[model samples]
Target: MLPSDCPISPLPRSAMLYCEIYAEVKPGLFSSEAKSQSSDRTMDLGLAEDHFSRPVDSFVASDIEQLKQAIEECKRLILELPEHSEKQKDTVVKLIHLRLKLQELKDPEEDEPNLRILLEHRFSKEKSKSVKQTCDKCSAIIWGLIQTWYTCTGCYYRCHSKCMNLITKPCVRSKVSHQSEYELNICPETGLDKQDYRCAECRTPVSLRGVPSEARQCDYTGQYYCSSCHWNDTGIIPARVIHNWEFEPRKVCRSSMRYLTLMISRPVLKLREINPLLFNFVEELVEIRKLRQDILLMKPYFITCKEAMEARLLLQLQDRQHFVENDDMYSLQDLIDISSGRLSCSLTEIHTTFAKHIKLDCERCQAKGFVCELCKEGDVLFPFDSHTSVCHDCSAVFHRDCYYDNSTTCPRCTRMTERKQDLPDEQDVGS
Candidate 1:
């Protein structure tokens, strides 16, 4: 449809319709103009104008551009995560927990040992031993898991070198403050070069070629003996063997000379020789205290006449205690008769002679021998014998013979050890 005013239009009615549709979809220009712009490489300005001008798609593209920007920001944040800071926070928490546990376990009342200490300060007094060329009074050895050896110039008694607990730092007793602790290369008593020697009791032979220290030649008899053996030979067993009759006397044995030598010598390993009978008596006391057995077994071994009487008195007391506790009280005469067995009168005589030395009451009379179970509540008791139980902590006592018949943990500290559990197929060997 060409108007008369419009110059001759070659377009058909369909082409005009197409142009109108195209302008509606991608507006702002005629189809011919749009095609001319696209062909000229300016892209279709009409299409861009139409896209910007139109209301954005509500259903399919709602806020899609904003969402994409947000997504990109999130990805960047993830890539730049602070991992080292998180790990440091975890480490800090763990360290705090460990410190708290350590604080809880700290014992404020414990005795703190000095971090740096000298050897002589710890082992001040010298211990002695007996050897042919050794000075019994000055011989000492250090005892430890790792040992060092030293030969005393004055006394040939071989000993551990570390036993010289030194006092470089002053202690309450400042006797060793003047001595130079660093002067260890030379022998203190003798000017001879210090050499290491091993005790006959604890000997270890090594190759001579690679010896760490200078080799020493001891002209000492190959027939060497330990301090214990020396004590035994010197009549430490007392009258068990009559000295001269049992062993031959040599021409070197001068009684006066022997007495003088003995006076100056420290009798190492001779605690029993000081008084053999006394040694036995102390041993029995320790045993009876540990094992509350009937004291009658000690009667046959007592060397002194006085000791026999004491043993009889002890047995009589036990018998008296048994009768009284069981409501079968003994008459005074019966008590006297029990105390007057062959050893009974002797016992009385001995007690009367040394009544001042003897404590009026025995250990049994004083409640020291028997413990009250009530005092040791909730604690375990390990019994050495029928009458005694020792708590591993606090040392609160119990008499198993007279009191509770059970085992448990210590009440004071609540310390306990879990024993291995019994299995079903295991046989009871004792039963």
Candidate 2:
């Protein structure tokens, strides 16, 4: 009971056999009687499709509203799925894509103007060798083989490409004011229970139960973070650098890593005030301190001398102006340079240049130099000279051996006291 003009009748024996079986299974769909019914249903479906379809350019506020609702629905579905399951992962990926599309429709501008700090995000395909890296924003596993992600060069903030645009956290280097001080304590870990067993950065509930819930301690801040907030990144802690002079790298959270990186070049550490004994142990520190003191003493001569000014004698210390201005403060980079002997070598060169100008080249500078009072030697003696000693009372300089032999008393102070005693007393003159 196939229609006589039915396309199923191809005249081939194999085609006829297949049509006969289809006709028996359906009984009416291929017959002439059912053609009219099928035509009516097709027309109804086409009308419904036409009612829903619109031009792409016709998108309005209502479409955006619909997208928002769809995104919320997707989020709900994701929450209902089992955590860490493949189905949940797929839903999260879909949700991120939908969010990206919504953002494009809302702003259209590729670059946002309200960003606090622009980060140079460098992406890498290789996984971290030490820790299993997770997205800092989403707390999701960064599947290096399948997903592309970015790590900030300044702060070491890691996140997925999809999460990068959504990041609202400012780079640690952006807040220079807050980075002036450092936590001086060495790994002063506050117990996890005090933090309510949560990550310090994200407030994610963590535990000591499983690998996924393992909490990592930041050596700088001494706070626990989840794997997402801490990727086992290591940095030299400022406290260790200042107190112990230990430059060995230690594990820190992302925030601490960024903060330490910002503080690396800043000369905010008052090393003398923090650890005065450090100078006694670190030979480079002691030598640098002495050199800085010498530079300070030589600064006035360079300023007054016309020849030294024309030659830009202070220009040699342009990069290290703090060495002339302050004797105690040191930066992390300065400490590293001192340990490597680079700072000492550079300071020695500058010191030699300054000494040459003060003692030999400039006549005016040499005239300012002191002649030893005890020995009465014509040879010039500077306060910075190793064989010279300055009197605390009269600010006069003398040979170290001569000053010690004279009971550490200044000759100028003795003469001034005797002259005052020889003069008539003020009360007797008034009488």
In terms of lDDT, which candidate is strongest? 2
lDDT of each: 0.29, 0.69
Question: Per-residue CA lDDT of candidate 2, range 82-145, in tens?
Answer: 4444554444444444554565565443232223234433333334433456787887766443
Q: How far off is residue 56 in model 2, in Å?
A: 13
lDDT of 2: 0.69
Give the TM-scores of the predictions, in the order they appear.
Answer: 0.18, 0.63
Mark the 10 consecutive residues where model 2 has the least summed lDDT. Answer: 37-46
lDDT, residue 405, model 2: 89
State how far residue 153 of model 2 sits from its true place (Å). Answer: 12
Give the range where candidate 1 is weakest over 10 consecutive residues by summed lDDT.
Answer: 237-246
Stretches of candidate 1 exceeding 4 Å from the true structure: 1-267, 270-371, 374-386, 401-405, 412-431
**CA shift at 115, candidate 2, in angstroms?**
5.8
